[model samples]
Target: MPDHAILTADAHRDLRVNTERSAASGDAVMSAMVVPDELRQVQNEYPILFRRNLEHDRFTALAMFGFEDGENLFLEGTRWAARYLPLSIAIQPFLIGRPEGADTGVRQVHIDLASPRLGSEGLRIFEEDGSPSPYFHAVVEKLGMLDAGYQASIGFLAALRRHDLLEPLSLEVPLADGSTHRLVGFHVIDEERLRALDPAAVAELHQAGHLMPIFMALASLANIGALVARKNQRLRHG
Candidate 1:
């Protein structure tokens, strides 16, 4: 359960967030939100896909970590097995929320006080003098980066929509125990459509810096094999 509250130095002076990778620390996740800026590096280790929100009619890019809910194949003991961690996962227990009566663009930091990661011991968020600590600064920086990345992603997503390049995807995996899992509700880049774009559109996309991420997202499909191998390894070891 989340007990979300505004993050303030006075109220959360003794609060700290655990950085370890474990279920108790809220690091056990199946997927994390991804942005265009991270597609190149994230595509190397995770499959990048788009998830649509039926209510809002919007699409969000995600980096798949596991085939099933509550399963994170990259988690190994107290450390994540991946060389790069998604910014969304790294910024756990902290979120950007709207301030009361504020307009749409107003964003404020909110903390999940009930998160298992919250404890008395860990990186201090505030010093004894009620000043932000180094850890706090780092978190703020990362949060800012996340905000900017999301803002920039709007243009990238619009570009994809304009070209009708998003296509539904279905994944089927055979496990070691002879059971197969079917994954759905995700979308991917349509490579054929992308390649078939008119030269003028291609040049426009290239000028907008969206071409690399499109290819990167398509390339991430190769990591699906690695994910399956990891799941099978876990099943055999268990």
Candidate 2:
């Protein structure tokens, strides 16, 4: 369980968070939830796929880093090997919260005291004068982006569904060790359907600001081959 508390300079003046990229710092993962806002950058490094949330009965995007659980091929030693990281991965141990009985529109910064990244070293959250440090501000910016993206995604996904542009994706990935991994329960943009759409439909998607993200998600599939190469290289070196 997480011990979440509203972040306050007076309560946590000396708090420092480990910014290192490592499994010990909780960076190891097969995938990270992503939003359409970051798809332009995320497409360059990860395969963007959509996942269905049964409980919510909605779709969400994910940036895949590996084919299996607990595996992150992007991690090379203590450093991440990508030029752009998903906002969901960059913002850790910090989340936006609202005060109980207050307006739900109000956003406040909250910190998890039990996170492994919280330690005596690394980036400081606040200065001695009780002001937010540069690192803290950067994190808040990411959290804001993530929050806005999450809200935008509700509309983006609905547009895709309305257009019948999403389809199930099943992949059989073969590695150097003669083993095959089957990827299931993931969806991708149906390029065929997208291309077959009428001009009015295309205009609607473009006007709604969803066309580019759909194209970016299609482009991201190219990275799957590179991700497989990384897994093969890791296998060879090990």
Candidate 3:
């Protein structure tokens, strides 16, 4: 028997590698101001939400997304929130400011579940429950997925499934241009926040006694640890 079996037939999983972004140089975009009215445009290119106070094992903490104009600027965990979301892609070892290496530098793997070919139920799950997920507002309302956050989440999740991993513990996200999306068909969520949000729902899945979640979580972490090692090595020699 495999260590991690599929929690649901639609779970997503994958391995990715990338180096972190470059450091602040002569005149980097230190900060920018954004307003609720401008959120749509800003998130278009920078889909992932992040804040200065929150620290993901592999992200820089800074208030870069929101507005400095004083009308709800994104402050990350304090304002913009992000974490090791449940998906199925491994994006890490990104080279921003540091020299690149072979799986040598830290890699950020994005794990998610998404597919253009999904059922109605699948799509509903994602929108109903997801963090930093303003994407849902329009979804359930039968409005539209014109929101950037919603679209990014959907595309990112679907991309994961296209990559191979099954989607589990899913949610439905919207896409730009007013399109509904069944992001992760299902994904293993092992975060405290998730647990806190929906213990009953998770418990139901656990009762099924599937190790898929554990495997998914560990797989992502193992990949991260490997990249961290390479990063540490480079820093040590430098």
Model 2 is weakest, by summed lDDT over 10 consecutive residues, at 89-98
Whole-model lDDT values for every prediction:
0.90, 0.93, 0.28
Instruction: TM-score for candidate 1, please give it.
Output: 0.95
Model 3, 1-238: lDDT tens per residue?
Answer: 1122222213421111111222211012223322222233333322222222225322111123212223221222222222321111101111012125646343222222232122332222232223212322233232122222333433433322333333234434333335433423123323544334356644644453322322333233233233233334434553
Q: Against the hidden reference, what TM-scores do the models get?
A: 0.95, 0.97, 0.19
lDDT of 2 by residue, 22-85 (tens): 9998889999999989999999889999989989988989999999899999998799999998
- Candidate whose TM-score is highest: 2
Error of 1 at 191 (Å): 0.4
Stretches off by above 4 angstroms in model 3 are 1-21, 25-203, 206-211
Q: Which stretches in model 2 have alpha-carbon errors above 4 Å? A: none
Q: Which scores greater on TM-score, model 1 or model 2?
A: 2
The clash count for each model shown is 0, 0, 59
* Poorest lDDT segment (10 consecutive residues) of candidate 3: 86-95
- In Å, residue 73's CA in model 1 sits off its true spot by 0.3
Query: How many collisions between residues are there in candidate 3?
Result: 59
